[model samples]
Target: MTLDERAARRRYATVSALFWLPLGLSIAPLVLLLTERGMAMTAVAGFFAAHSLTTAALELPTGGLSDVIGRRNVLAAAGLLNLAALTLLGLGTTPVLLGLGMALMGAARALSSGPAEAWYVDTVHAHAGPDAELRTGLARGATATDAALAVGTLTGGALPWLIGLAPELGARLGEATSGLVLPLSVPLLLGAAVEIAFVSYALSALPEPPRPPTPLRHVLRDVPATVAGGLRLGGRDALVRRVLVSAGAAGSALATAELLTPGRAADLTGAPESGAVLFAALACAGFACAAVGAHLAPLTARRTGGGERAIAASLTTSAAGLLLLGVTTALPGAFALALAAVGYGLVYLGLGATGPNENDLLHRRVSSTGRATALSVQSLALQLTAALTGLIVTVLPPGPLPWSLAGAALLAGALLWARGGSESRPYAIPDATGGPDATAERRPGHGRPLGGRTGARE
Candidate 1:
């Protein structure tokens, strides 16, 4: 059965929207409350720092798990973990419990990140064939995350007032987002419920595609080789490396904002609650801008002839935005916030456009049965980059550090722009021609006789 590209892609998009809505809802208020409850200035640094550590630890292993078991299982497990984390977070307010909660969230995020795209690709590839649509859909799926974030943020912000009005109407569920009794916790519980619902949706709505019954043990053992190969592949393909590196740098810069913004806002606002206002504005603005920017993806791709160069441009623009944001004392902070909001907006769109190209690069090089393994390897790189970005932001001074991160990220973009297609132009897999024996025509996972589907499992 050929994969119906649009149908499967829509499912993947739904997956992103459903999975991320709860994530944003839970995250926004929880971070605010956690800071108020126990995040001393010192502990504040550790929050994003710990995210990096937890992210790195879980990333590759979960990716590998998807290859062996299935992406569906990985996503389901992530949702279940989110539910548990939010539950623990709501029930406990102590430092240790909060740390556990944060760690759980990080792990779930890392696990859910890459495997979903790989699964969607496999499904799409199985049914129809590879083309630009798969790439576009993959990226749009990610951008849809910003939309979900916006909707969830607005909903969370409004939920408390809507619930409190029940007093006049004589209703009972209680105010969820109101500062009255920690509306922060309410979002988490609600978000977890949404994710569980999404899990059920996935189970009932999406049918699993056939896959090789590769032994779990052999797949586990091959993870190291797979990772090494993926990195090497990045090195070998300039465009893929450019896209990955540029995206990573841009990602790091954004993570830096996420790392420092709350603390910065607290200093400026003199009220912890005010930070949530700024945070929501930045998040919602970024989301709105990103959605609009995603529509320009095809244009960016057309200009660059690939996503890597476009991603580079995004990083450079982000650097400029961060630099502008750094001197908020002079710009009066609001303007700086506006820049960052718009900056992140474009950043998400740029990455979204380029995401498919990089993934397609890998899929083109590998056979069908080996796509998951190869994808896991790439996921590891992306996650590790994000982890590093978070860690760097945690350690650096909150004010100018974002500027520095953005600048460094711009350097990555510059390098990619300079490198161009000299290397990438070669081995450039043409878009797959729809035909029988898709496997017969495609490249092997590792380009080794031993890298065949059966050999990979062993």
Candidate 2:
């Protein structure tokens, strides 16, 4: 790689780690925290749905906003929103306040989703050309993200426990904060601090390539068109369509795991506090597994001779993990807990492996102009499906059924790529302007069939 390419990769990885760490810190204890604050399971599910719904509503617009206004600005806005959201989450006692916090978080999630990765791709493409080997760099970034999550989750999980160990400190903190401070709130407050750091780092470190200054009217007009164009890609391009479907399935699978796993931990441990600890350990392990899988993505793609096969294999692995979790839900004692942990880790691993390969394929399909928008479209599918899944799982009896349904969805998604031939082959995508015959200008490797390493089109 060239010096510029290497630098871009490093920056990408660094930004990825920073962006995800705060989220990692809050994931394990969020449900537990909500429950402690008097939310029923259905209420928690509703909050989750609200978050996902908000994200879905904003995904395309923010994606277009980033593409037009620049990634740095959009990312900075996301960090700021997160700071406010986390603060509200840490301090707010009422359901209304909590719901508002969740909404802000959702907006933050939407704004943050595609910009950084888009910036990385655009930077590397500018320096190294269109067909640059994206998987290796993308894998490294994915690994860094999961690594941050692993470390942050373990620390976040343990923070509450450590606080409890110091009763006087805990009491003083509660008293100082007027009874708002608690073990669960500590990680979120820390996450807010991290967001401050994130904003500072982003402003100072993230450089943007110059774009023609867009007028407010132009931005308003162009963003909607860009969003429309992005949505069209799913309908117009065969591979893009399949990728969107796969993203949806993956979302459902993730929703199932996220909704069920913490409760499962609580069941095994028999208390919310103990469950938080167990969930933290499990989340840490899962993130570690995800990191391993991300680091192994390029190797897996190479071994399988193409990205498509690797994606299918990863999806199948994820489905099997869900199946395992479902089947073992009824097991007795320690064995069930152990199996659940393994299953959880496996699902994360599969997702980790799948992400880079899938995005690598996606990156080849669209130009830098529409890259972030395309990614947002993918995220939209994921979040929408996840929101629906969250609602569905809430209504279903808590057992293997929800998990089995998720596994089945994942299995169907796996088959989409596994069927091979027409489905796995990329097709030319229309440009963001919706110009006719745009496909005629398809990049050399853009819509190639995946097969041998020579056709890997890295």
Candidate 3:
């Protein structure tokens, strides 16, 4: 790799780490915090659904916005939005206010989704040429993201308990604030501070590539065309369509794990506060496992004979983990908690492994101009399916059933890429003559080769 390419990779990994850390800090305790504020489980589900719905509604638009405006600008905007949203989440007591906060958070998530990665891809391709290797850098960024989450989850989980230990401090702070301040809110407020850092860093660290100048009117006119073109790719390209479906299945698996795991942790611990700590530890462990899986992706792909096959195997492993979680719901004591933790960790590991492999394929199918939009489309599918899955799981009685259903869905998704043959090889776009083409073929002889040149046109 060139020096410029190495610098770009470092920047990408830094952005990935920064982007995920605050979110990890907030995620482990969010449900418990809301419930502590007097929300019932159903109400909590509604809040989650609201967040998902908002993200889904805005995903495509924000993706196009990134393509229209500069990626750095859109990322900065997302960080600013997250600052407001986290503040509201930390301070608000009423459901309406909190719901608004959740909606804003979703908007932030949508805006942030593809810009950083898009910037990295665009930058690397510009510096290193289209056929430059991408998987190694991409995988490194993924590992960095998971590592941030692991650290943040561990610290966030412990913050509330640490705060509670200082009775005199807590009492004085409580009195000064008229009891609005609480131990549980500290981590979220800290997360808000992190957003400030994120916004500043994004503006300073990410450079925008030169493109055709887009005025407000031009953006308004052209963004829809870009979005439509991106949407059309899913139907026009068989590989992109399958990738979308796989994203949806992955979303379902994620929704099931996030929704049910905290409750299970609480049940094991017999208290919400303790549950937060336990869940945080579990989340940290899961993210650690995810990092390992992401780091091992290249090797896994080579061993499995292709990226598609690796994805299939990873998804199947995730399904089995979910199945284990479902089946062990009735087990007693520490054993069950241990089993659940393993299951949870495995799911994250599988997801970590699956993501880069799938994205590498998707990147091969689209041009740079539409890359962010294509990623948004994939995210839209995931969020939409997750929102639906959340609703369905909410009404079902807690047990093995919801998890089993999720596992089944993941298994079905795996089957989409399970077939062995030339299809498992790195995908090549058809040539103008409509014959087999090798212009953008993956590096020869490896099913899941890392760092091959990207074929997407600008």
Task: State which candidate has the highest TM-score.
Answer: 2
Query: CA lDDT of each candidate?
Result: 0.60, 0.83, 0.81
Task: Specify the poorest-scoring 10-residue window by lDDT in model 1.
Answer: 449-458
Tens digits of per-residue lDDT, candidate 3, 1-458, equal 22367788788888888888888888766877898889899988889778878998899988888877879899999988888988888888999988988999999999998888888878877786766666667777788999999988887778887878888887887788887777777778888899888888888887775567778898997678768867877877787888999999999999999888888889888898788678777878889988987876766676787778888998998998999899778898989888888899889899888887787677666666677888899999998898799889878999999999999999998999897444445655422112233135654443335433322111
Of 2 and 3, the candidate ahead on TM-score is 2
Instruction: Give the per-residue lDDT of model 1 (tens digit) for 1-458.
Output: 44476777678778888888987776456655676566685674576567667877766566556655667777888888777777766656677777777788778877786666777777766675543234456556766776888788878766654655656432333244233345456677788789788788766655666557777677677655454444455565544565556556656666766666667666556677887687677677766666655545445544665444554554455565566556663444466556555554545444444454455455655544335545555556666666677766677655665556665675666566643443234344311111143234433232111212111110
Candidate 2 vs. true structure, TM-score: 0.89
State in Å the error of residue 201, model 1.
2.4
Lowest summed lDDT across 10 adjacent residues in model 2 is found at 449-458
Clashing residue pair totals per candidate (backbone < 3 A):
3, 0, 5
Candidate 1 versus truth, CA RMSD in Å, comes to: 7.5
Determine the backbone clash count of candidate 3.
5
In the predicted model 3, the residue pairs found to clash are 131-453, 132-453, 133-451, 134-451, 306-447
TM-score of each: 0.77, 0.89, 0.88
Best by lDDT: 2
